[model samples]
Target chain A: MLTIHCPCCGVTAEETEFHAHGEAHLKRFGPGSSEDEFEGYLFMRKNPKGVHFERWRHQYGCGKWFHVARCTMTLEVFGSYSAQTTEPPQEIMDIIHDRRPDTAAGPAR
Target chain B: MSDPVSALKNIFDDTGLVRVSEIGPIGMVTLRGDLSDKVLGKAAVAAGGVNLPEQGQCNTEGSQGIAWMSSDELLIMCPYADVHARLADLQEKLAGSHALAVNVSDARAVFDITGDHLREVIAKLAPVDMHPDQFNGTMFRRTRFAQVPAAFWMPDGRSARIVCFRSVAQYMFDLLKDAAMPGSEVRHYA
Candidate 1:
């Protein structure tokens, strides 16, 4: 089970208490937007074996949504941060880069 | 108006290893604000008769208590009869501030589970760490009690005060009883 640290409550809890909400940092397109963009926004996801960003809801704890960065291969959590931002915080990115220098800066395919 | 009835009607069970009692209807205020802010802290202390507890902590003086439910939420407990008055007082004190103080006594249920191996009984249910070193007095945990969301704090070494939604009181009561049943002891936290 993934151990998640909720940025809002600062509680490190098991994944059972949290609900995964698919990929994070999603930008929505609507109305006059092209069908491709809308379809990509709804269905396209970065299912990377390496580092990936996802959203999580602390369902049983504080009932707040947050972001989690982790590696799908090793199951190593990069870090968790607030959902109020558009991208992963610099600290988490820096840690990821520092830990895996050979890996690409972001999820690639 | 009509009489106030608790979800479990003060049901007590000692037939099992531990003592499980559906505590009487107690006053609970779901106070939401910036807990770190001095203004909110002062209002909480004033209304709850206790200082604002730290994260994952609860401070209780008899029936009056203030538990840190989250970074922005506090569960202030008072006597059931005094809930409305306390809530109004909290609201008046928090005027002009971004805050929410509402009485949640009727919507919630509380239980007192006491015994020598109470931790073992609770450890079987929640996903929380139930060891004494981690789940000691003053520590507050919001977790799934079997299936529904519930919170619990050790009032003392032998007893815990569990709070959950009133709608799940029956389910919570049964979960606790079954966990604390004779011969069903896991002896992990024992």
Candidate 2:
């Protein structure tokens, strides 16, 4: 099982202790946005095989939601950060770039 | 307004390798505030008569027990008789801070299980690593017990104090009994 380090609880718990909730840092397209933009926000998702970002709840650990940067292909977790922020921190972004230089510098649109 | 009743009248009297007992009419509150704020800790101690535990730890001073639920949260448990007064006192102490004190006594069920085979039974139900080397008295874990979410702490080698939402108390109790059967396999520490 995947061992996820829950920053809030300060525990590295097994996958059973967590619940993955899809993409992290999702940009919301609320009222007044174009239909296409709203549709994209609702149904569009990233299925990257390499470095991917995700939102996960440490449901059985801290009961807090957090973000994770991981490689879908190799299961190499880049790192975890708090869910309270709007975007991944610069240090985490730098680590991702250092490990997978091919990834773009900003959030994938 | 009505008098409270115990879910399990005498679970403590059971004879087996394990003994499970309901632990309240106790005061329970979920306390939230910035961990870095000294006033938050001070307020918690003021209400519960004990220092707030650090991450993954639990502390008991007198009838009050504080379990750290996360970096900025803790569960304060004390005698039910003192609940409302303690809540008011805590709110007063934390008036100027970014804090929330929620009374959860009615929403929770607390149970204590003691046995020589405590860890063995728990291994069957949850994915937690309860090897004596990895977990001990100072630690508490929020984890799923079988299919329901629960949290527990081993107060000693032979006992664990477990808490879960009241809705799932019966399910949790039955699951523990089934896992502690005489022929159940004792999980080896990895």
Candidate 3:
């Protein structure tokens, strides 16, 4: 029963309305690409054990696509933002710290 | 004869303002791929000039319509008469791409459900919150309607349209009939 924040609707919503798209920030090669290059792009994935950024779709709600940063081990969400935004929302980060006192020591930098 | 399409027609008449029209033989293709990929983007443009709409959104070009069913899936619709040739052209243009275009035209049927209470009727079936403001223009949905797999398109909230597999059309029609008749006893014997 996790409440995920939607950057499009600007509200936390039940997890059922959103779908987790694995690992964000993928790079694509141009046309007439080599076999190894294309294979690497398609088959590679990063299964990080700690804080990671992932894409998610607000499927049943606003239907907008966005990104979320969370700790993979604890499933503690740190922040969420629209795909177009360069930075995550500060308020969301603040709330994350407020709710999880132990993680409030400092930023994940 | 208790046919499903006819049953739908009967319900439409009883509902007063609503009218049901069959958009049969329409060519429907399901496209799946990464939205940000250039190859996928080119394939979408080659299919019809417009990229698939955002999830829950529909893009219409003349008689053709494409709805985004999920982040990586899109439903393509074109008039029955134009399907075969158009699909071939699209397939040729999208060759070698990491996308997959599946022909599902024969597997589905399209129904145009229009009139004032269409939204209310849909609320009785699907789990989506189909409110006027939240799900208006450009909004579409891939959800279950009366326990049938359906993809809905709302040109406007007042007039709702649904496309579903042909096999479940009868089940949906029966659900609509019972819904229209409130407390009436409409039993289905196996």
Candidate 4:
């Protein structure tokens, strides 16, 4: 069982304590946007085999949502962070890169 | 005002290793604000008669308490009869601020479990680290308890108080009774 830490509550508990919402840092396309842009925003998702950014809700704890950096292949978690920001914090990216040096450099999404 | 009734009408059971009681129609205010804001703490104490609790902490004095529920939320507890008055006072004090205080007493239920080896009963249902070394009276935890969301805190080493949605009061009570049933002691926290 995966153990996840909620950055908001600072509690590390079993993954059952959290709910995975999948993917993170999604940009919304509104009514004025092109049809393709809206469609892409609604249906397109990344299914990376390696480092991936995802959103997790601390459903049982603080009831706050946060971002998690995890490796899809090994299930190794890099870090959990605040969900208020548009991108993963620099330190989290640094940690992810440090562990998976072969992963492509992250740019602002 | 109509006569108040608790979720479970104040049920009590003592047949298990621990005694469980559905404590009351306890006054609860869901306060959302910036925890670090000085004004927020001042208003909370004024309304609840307790100081602001630190992260995952609970502070109580007399019939009132304040528990840190999240980074942006605190649950202020007071006597049931004083709920509306306290909430009004809290709102007046926090006017023009980015804060919200709502009465949640009727929408929630509270249970008090008292007996020896307090942590063991909670460990059976919650994923929290209930070991005595990691948990104590001053700490508060919100977790999944038997497939439902609940929050709990110890008033002392031998007693704990839990809060869950009113709709789940019966389920929570049943789960607590089963966990505290005789012959179920794991002795992990002993």
Candidate 3's docking class is incorrect
Q: State the displacement of the C-alpha of residue A4, model 4, in Å, after optimal TM-score superposition.
A: 1.4
Question: Estimated TM-score per prediction?
Answer: 0.93, 0.87, 0.60, 0.93
| Per-residue accuracy of model 1 over B1-190 as CA lDDT, tens digit each | 9989899899999999799999969999999988877888898999899877888899999999999888789999999998999999889989978999988999999999999878888888888888877778688889898799999998888899999999999999999999988988777765
The collision pairs in model 3 are B56-B140
Compared with the true structure, what per-residue lDDT tens digits does model 4 show for residues A8-102? 88999989999999889888999999999999789888888888889999988898999898888899888899999998898998998799888
Structural similarity of chain A in candidate 1, as TM-score: 0.94
> DockQ of candidates 1 onward, in order?
0.75, 0.72, 0.07, 0.85
* C-alpha lDDT of all candidate models, in order: 0.89, 0.82, 0.66, 0.90
Give one digit per residue, the lDDT tens place, for model 3 in A1-109. 5568776655355576578888766666558999877886788776766556678987654467898878778887877877875445677567656765565432222
Off by over 4 Å in 4: A105-109
Candidate 4 lDDT over residue span B154-173, tens digit each: 88888999999999999999
Residue B47 lDDT in candidate 2: 81
Best by DockQ: 4
